[model samples]
Target: MSGNFKMLAKTLYGFEPILAKELRNLGAGNVEEGVRNVTFDGDTGFLYKANLCLRTALKIMKPISRFRVFSEKELYRQVYDIDWSDLFDHDKTFAIDTTMNSEVFNNSLFVSQRAKDAIVDKFRATTRQRPNVNTHDPDIRINIHLYKNSCTVSLDSSGTSLHQRGYRISTNIAPINEVLAAGLLLTSGWNGTTDFLDPMCGSGTFLIEAAMIACNVPANINRSSYSFMHWNDFDDELYEKIIAASLNKTREFHHKIIGYDKAPSATRKAQENVDNANLSEYITIERKDFFRTEKPVDTKLHMVFNPPYGERLQIDVEDFYAKIGNTLKQNYPGTNAWLITSNLEALKYVGLRPSRKIKAFNGKLESRLVKYEMYEGSKKAKYKTDTQ
Candidate 1:
């Protein structure tokens, strides 16, 4: 907790590499990527920075103890032995969340219950009082990860998921997750170098995320609270310094970020969210159907959007997708268009073979992020039709 300590950042599926890269960029040591999480070494100040700056991370956890427990009694004993009093006060409400993948311990709820009892007993024995349990929202959140026989206990530094960036209060139908939007933009190699557009911008998640990435701004600058502030060792001065330093690193972006949606309600919601993020100067939201309009900018354009899948909205899948292809091929030349959709069958009707296809997930639905490159002139021969 003083000089340096190991921490874990949890992310969505396929975002481990992005999270690891973010950790390394933030000056973390011994960076490692796991399935849906990244592990790194950082000090207490670095921990604060990670919570504030990481865009793709859902939660940041500091592992306090790791042990082998084969039985329920052993689990309780190992958890009780730790000095829970040293971590937080007896009056502070606490909650134990458990996740396990072990043949020995089949129930995660039972494990959480036992750990909670152990902590309560420890407090009662030491201070003659016990901390109350808060299941919904607690001052202190302790994580219990049981893999086979190994258990790793960690303190949750981030109370809510980082995707709740505190900027999006208004959302349209089926808005994309903020973390997922940021990850897909980073994966698409968006560096804020050229004009950007989101043709089907729902709730302006991509628009806001793209502007933040463009300006090198901290992702959660608008968020006011984190679980670290509730810890006994929380340093107010150090956290303020970290926040100021991050704001100082924000560079100016010289590109237009535009968003368009057919629905007036969607456009209004996106504008409100963008205004809440304080990014109205950097982003512009409009009500225009993508298929009915041409490219807004003459220079190079980079687009990433979450289009409506046939499964979510009732529409003619083939006609909608075909119109999408026709609009791009005829009007929006000199552009790179990337869209994510769970409707895999609609790709065949787009009429343009995708230049790049990456497997992704949109919530519980499996999706594909496909890309199409439109050249400046004579774009017909540059792309191949599905029939060809």
Candidate 2:
């Protein structure tokens, strides 16, 4: 393996440990968990593998340079010191994204502009032509992180965010992000041992992610592009070998993965997305109101879903949540049901005391991932309330 370098994988809140564990399992060296990112050492092939297989990662970045800067001039000098031509050609278009948490840099846009100037100047001095900056779509995407007086410049190896797995061409209203979906499933400890279900399976994100986890399928198997592919040092043969090896590691899944949605359009979209992900063999979607359905499986089932949170969909939040509780208590037995919702007021109407409640965020909204365990042959779940 050539070009063994340190890479940082960014993830959502409460997922650092899982991301670190995943990196270690993937044979990454020096796997260290940061606030919302994981740092690891891997070669180019390993980078491709990480981007393709990491379910919880939102982006994988390859750091090219690091320096200290107390002022704008120092920042420009530091940015210019790096050999930009070594990373990409002058013919390519590039964009700079900056994240600043420092006293020296006031505005991230200004920092990006300075960084861009340094790179363009370097390119012009070397090749007599500078790469144009394309903010929307760029051949090379550079990331600048300024913490206090220290700065880290990295190449965005996963160009368009790993969440765009390329399989979800169709989506229903309030469709969850693929990376978030995978992280939530991982957090719930879904390991393919039990049957899986997503009652309000809008676009079947949970079902598809669950099936992939159960079958040991790579997370970004359907994704076609990566930022590293445009890098100057990219090796086609090595990347192809990594893909082939990853595909070879996919295992068999036995348990059933089911999805139910009240809306026929949602069910159809989920089915189409599932089929697009090549997971139709492991997942099944049906148009049925979850409130009207019973536990389909005889064995212990693991259920996870995101119900209508009253933000996007128009529904009586109180009644909808109460019905969810009623359905689980009356029909679902021998099941571990987990749901994420931001509607705190509606959660009270569920009429169930969650056995476990984990604080989480659905995008910017503060949310809770509550769990309800319904024992076998028991009419009431662990968290039944008399309010119903």
Backbone N/Cα/C clashes per model: 0, 0
What would the TM-score be for candidate 1 when compared with the true structure? 0.97
Cα RMSD of all models vs. native, in order, equals: 2.9, 3.4
- Candidate 1: misplaced stretches above 4 Å? 379-388
lDDT of 1 by residue, 147-208 (tens): 99999999999988899999998987788999999999999999999999999997999999
lDDT of 2 by residue, 155-254 (tens): 9999998988889978887888888889889889899999999999998888999999999899999988887888888888988888899999999988
Candidate that scores best on lDDT: 1
What is candidate 1's local distance difference test score?
0.93
Q: Which ten residues in a row have the lowest lDDT in candidate 1?
A: 378-387
In terms of TM-score, the best-performing candidate is 1
lDDT of each: 0.93, 0.90
lDDT for 311 in candidate 2 is 93
